[model samples]
Target: MSKTNAARILDRLKLPYEILEYAVDPDDLAAESTAEKLGLPPEQVFKTLVARGDRHGVCLAVIPGSAQLDLKALAVLAGDRKTDTVPLKDVQPLTGYVRGGVTALGTKKAYPVYVDELMLTFETVAVSAGKRGLMLWLAPQAYLTATQGIVGAIARSSPP
Candidate 1:
């Protein structure tokens, strides 16, 4: 299998991780859908979101499929008046990855990264391996360390 941006970052950081690949329909894959396809719990899978902070250039948020990013919390963490998610068009050039394939690591620029504190509860967490149909399972701390991510309670329950 080809190494993804996430895998490349992990390898560069010398962190141990396992890559998992499965069939995925790029047009229809969602975090929840990917989790189901891989036979993994939704909470174990995370999605990477790029947000624009009022003063903080660009920031990355990592949250479980079962949770939602708390914009207010992120604003506070970023010390900004507010924060807004970057649109799909802007994300690719900024992060050098498509919406469903963005990884916290290997972005075009080194933006501040935040990972939901809840992820620490799991021994291993899965994140996009920089492409559709691929994921990586590794210690959450390893991910944080590799990305220089800040841990915070920046996630909220998903809407019904």
Candidate 2:
């Protein structure tokens, strides 16, 4: 497969990563499913979310596939009083990535990136390759450095 903008950015940074592709199930775009398809546990896969802070405008929140973004926690980290996920209709225009394909590496703009501290526990984490059906696997620290990500407790366990 041709390289994606995310991969290109990694190359420019001289970071090593592996691209893995799976069959895309349009009906099941959940990160959990993506992890399953890749034979990985959900927490090993990170999903990027777009959130708008009342003061900071837009930022990226990356959390484990099995967790959910904690808006309040994110707001604290972004230094905003309030934050909410951007509307679905605004996601593509804002980040140049569709729902299932969003990644913090190479967005349309360099929005501040907030990554859940959980990712640091793993040697490598999987994130979208700027498109659906494709995933990028790299050392968490390398990915964080590439995106200039801020680490924080910005995610919470999904409700049972």
Candidate 3:
């Protein structure tokens, strides 16, 4: 598989990461499904979400696959009075990645990134490799270092 922009950034930073590829299920692009395919707990797989703050414009939220982005919490972290997830159609143009492939690394623009505090509890986490069907596995600290992400309680359990 050809290296993605995200991977190239990691390479330049001299960070060690492993790229894992899986089949893409167009009908099921949920990060939870990707975790299941990789035989990992959903909590270990992080999903990147694009959100726009009323004041800050756009930022990326990295939360566990099984959790939902807490917009209010994110707003607090981003110092915005309000925040909302960007429309699906705007994701690619804003981040240069499709819906199932958004990552903080190598975005078309460098947006502030906020990662859920839960990620620190895990030794490693998996995030999109800037495209669907591929995941990058690296230590939580390594991921943070690469993205310079802020750590906060920006996630909540998904409603049943």
Candidate-wise lDDT, in order? 0.89, 0.96, 0.96
Question: What TM-score would every model get versus the actual structure?
Answer: 0.96, 0.99, 0.98
Better of 1 and 2 by TM-score: 2
Residue pairs in collision within model 3: none
Locate the minimum summed-lDDT window of 10 residues in model 2.
Answer: 101-110
Error of 1 at 2 (Å): 1.2
TM-score of 2: 0.99
Residue 90 local lDDT, model 3: 97
Q: Write the per-residue lDDT of candidate 3 for residues 1-160, one digit (tens) a residue.
A: 9999999999999999999999999999999999999999998999999999999899999999999999999999999999999999999999999989999999999999999999999988999999899999999998999999999999999988
What does candidate 1's lDDT look like per residue over 13-128, in tens digits?
A: 89999998878787876888889888999889999999999888799999998888899999998788999898889999999888778888889899999899988999999998
lDDT of 2 by residue, 10-100 (tens): 9999999999999999999999999999999999999999999999899999999999999999999999999999999999999999999
